[model samples]
Target: MSVKYAKRMDYIKGSAIRELLKLTEQPEIISFAGGLPAPELFPIEEMKEVCVRVLDTDGKAALQYSPTEGYMPLRKIIAERMKKSGVEISPEHILITSGSQQGLDFCGKVFLDEGDTVICESPSYLGALNAFKSYLPKFVEVEMDKDGMKMDELEKALQANPNAKFIYTIPDFQNPSGITMSVERRKKLVELAVKYNVPVVEDNPYGELRFEGERLPAIKHFDTEGMVIFLGTFSKIFSPGLRVGWVAASPEIVRKYVLVKQGADLQSNSMAQREAAAFVQMFDLDAHINKIIEVYRKRRDLMIETMEKEFPEGFTFTYPNGGLFTWVEMPEGVDAAEVLKKALEEKVAFVPGGSFYPNGGNENHCRLNYSCMPEDKIVEGITRLGKVFKKL
Candidate 1:
C-alpha cells in the first residue's frame, strides 16, 4: 500500500548538511560540514546549578504547561536583549518558539501561498530555503557582493515580483556566505522594503558573535513602519540543545504568530524556558558570550590561515569576522560534490555549495565550518581538502 503525501513533500528535501553530518560521525573524519558551536564552551557546570535552582524555585511551573505566548520572564529578558540590536520592543510583542527554524516555518505559513514569490540572496541559508520551498513559492534569487546582498539586484527583483510574500535575509555573518551587509545597505534595504510594501524577515543567529569591529545595528533597527520580523536565537551563543528562539515584531504581527504557535505545539518547552531564564539571572550571559567569542575567533583565524597556505590557487574563501562557516569557491567547471568524494577518502567532509542556491547551477563551491573543530583538526582538514582540490 502507498501512502498519500501532501504535494509540498515533493518539493521538500532533506538538508545537505544534515545528511553530510551522518557520514562524518566517524571519529577519524575531520568534518567541516556542520555549523556547530564548540561543545567545550557550553556552560554545563553552570547549567547543572541553574537546573537545580529552577527545580527548587519553580518546579511545578517548570514542568507544567504554559501560555502560547511563552514565559513572561523569558520574554522580558528577550525584549531587553533586543535593545542591543537597536529595536525597542515589549514582551507582549514577542513569541518564543522551539527555535528560529520554527519561526522560519511560521513565516512561510503566515505569508506564503502556492505560486507566491520569495526574494532572497543568490546563495542563502539552506534551512530557510527548504522551509520556504515546502510552501511551493517561486524563489527569485538576487546576486550579492562583498558587503552582502546587492541592493540594486534586490530592488530589481522586488520590482519584477511586486507581489512577493516577503524578503528573507541573514544580514549578519550570513550562513553559507559569511558576508555581512554594510550599514549603508541595511538602511537601503529597509527603504526598499517600505517602497515595495513587503515585510522583511531578518534571521540573526550570529549578530552578537562579533570577534572584531563595532557591532552593526540590525536591519530591524531601520524599520519604522513595523514591517520587519526579527528572528533571534540562543542556539549560537548559549545552546542549541535547548531549542529556544523567538519572533519579535509588531503586536499585531506577533498575535498572528501566537495563533500559529497554538496550532503548532500549543507552546514551547516550559522547563527549558525556566532553565534559560534562571541561567541568565544567576550568571553573566554577556561574559559567557565573550568566552565563546574568544574560542571561535581563534578557530576562525586558524582555519583562514590554513586555507591560505594550503589551498590551491584559483580557490577562494571568505574571511568572516565572526560566524561558523566560510564559503569556498572552486575553479570553474569543478563540482564540489565530486571533490567531496575524494576528500572523504582522506576522512575529511564538507558541504557542497550547489544546494545552497534554491534555483541551482553553481556547483563549484563548498561551505567549511570552523567553529566545531579544534586548531589541530582545522589545519589537518584544510590540508586534506587542499590536496583533494589540487588533484582535480
Candidate 2:
C-alpha cells in the first residue's frame, strides 16, 4: 500500500547532528556532535528532593493539567530574571514551553508564512533552522564576523528584505560558531531591527553559561517597543530531561503563543514544571550554575589546547570565552561532511558546519562540543581527528 504524508513533511529532514548522534551510540565513538550539557553536572540529588516534595505536598496540582500559559510560579521567576537582564517583562508576558525548541516552533507558527523572508546569522543554530523549516520560510543568511553578526551586512539584509518577518539570532556564545556578539554589535542589532520594523527572535539558551567574559546585555534588553521575542531555557543550566523553557514577548504575541501552546500539547508537563519551580526556589541555582561553569570552563580550555596542538596547520577554530561549542574551519575545498565520515570511522564524531547553515554552504567547517565529554576524551578525540586531517 502506498502511504501519503503532508506536503510540509517533505521539507523536514532528519537532523545531521541527530544522525551523527546515532553513530556515536557505538561504545568506541567519542562524540563532539551534540550541543548537550554535561550530565555529570546535573543536580540529581537536588532534583530528586524537589520531585519528592512536589509529589508529597502538591500531588494534585503537579499531576493535573496546567494552563497553556504555563506554571505561574515558573513564569514569574523567568520574568524576574529577564528584569535583571534589563528587559522589564512580567509573568503576563511570558509563556512556558516544553523547551526553547518549542518556543521556536511557536514563533514560527505565529510569525512566519510560507515564502516569508527570515534572516539569520550565517551558520546559525540547526535546531532553529529545523524548527523554521516546517513553515517553509525563505531563509536569507547574514554574514558573521569574529565579534558576531556584521552590523553593516545586517542593515543591508534588512534593507533588501524590507518585509523580513523576523531576524533570529543567538547572540551569546552562538551554537556551532560559539561566537559571542559584542555589546556594540548587540546595540547595533537592536537599532537595525527597530529601523527596519522587523522583530528579532533572540534565542539565548547559553547566556547563563558564560565562564570568563564580560556580560553583554541581550538585544531584548534594548527593545522598548516589544520588537524582540526572547527565548530562554533551563536545559543548559539545570537539566534537559526536565524539558523546561520560557518565552518573553509582547502581550499580544504571548497570547497567540498561548493559543498555539494549547493546540500543541495542552501544556508542558505540570510535574516537571512544579519540580523546576521547586528546584529554582528551594535550591541555590546560581551556585549550581557556577559549578557547571567551572566544569565547562576547564573542558573548554582542554579542548582548545588539544585543538591547537593536534589539528592540522591550516585548521582554524573559534576561541570562545564561554560556550559548549568551538567551530573548526578547514582549509578551502575540504568537505566537512566527508571528513565527518572519516571521523566516524576513527570513532570520533562532530557535526559538519553545513548542517548549521540554511543552504549547506560551509563545506570546510564543523562544530565541536566540549561540555559533554570528559577532558581525556576531548584530547583523545582531537588526536584521532588530527590523524584524519593528516590523511586529508
Best by TM-score: 1
Cα shift from native, residue 229, model 2 (Å): 0.2
After superposing candidate 1 on the true structure, give the runs of residues whose Cα lies further than 4 Å from its correct spot.
Answer: none
lDDT of 1 by residue, 213-279 (tens): 9999999999899999999999999999999999999888999998989999999999999999998
lDDT, candidate 2, at 260: 90
lDDT of 1 at 276: 90
| lDDT for position 381 in model 1 | 89
Model 1 clashes, total count: 0
Off by over 4 Å in 2: none
| Residue 69 lDDT (model 2) | 87
Q: What is the lDDT of residue 127 in candidate 1?
A: 96
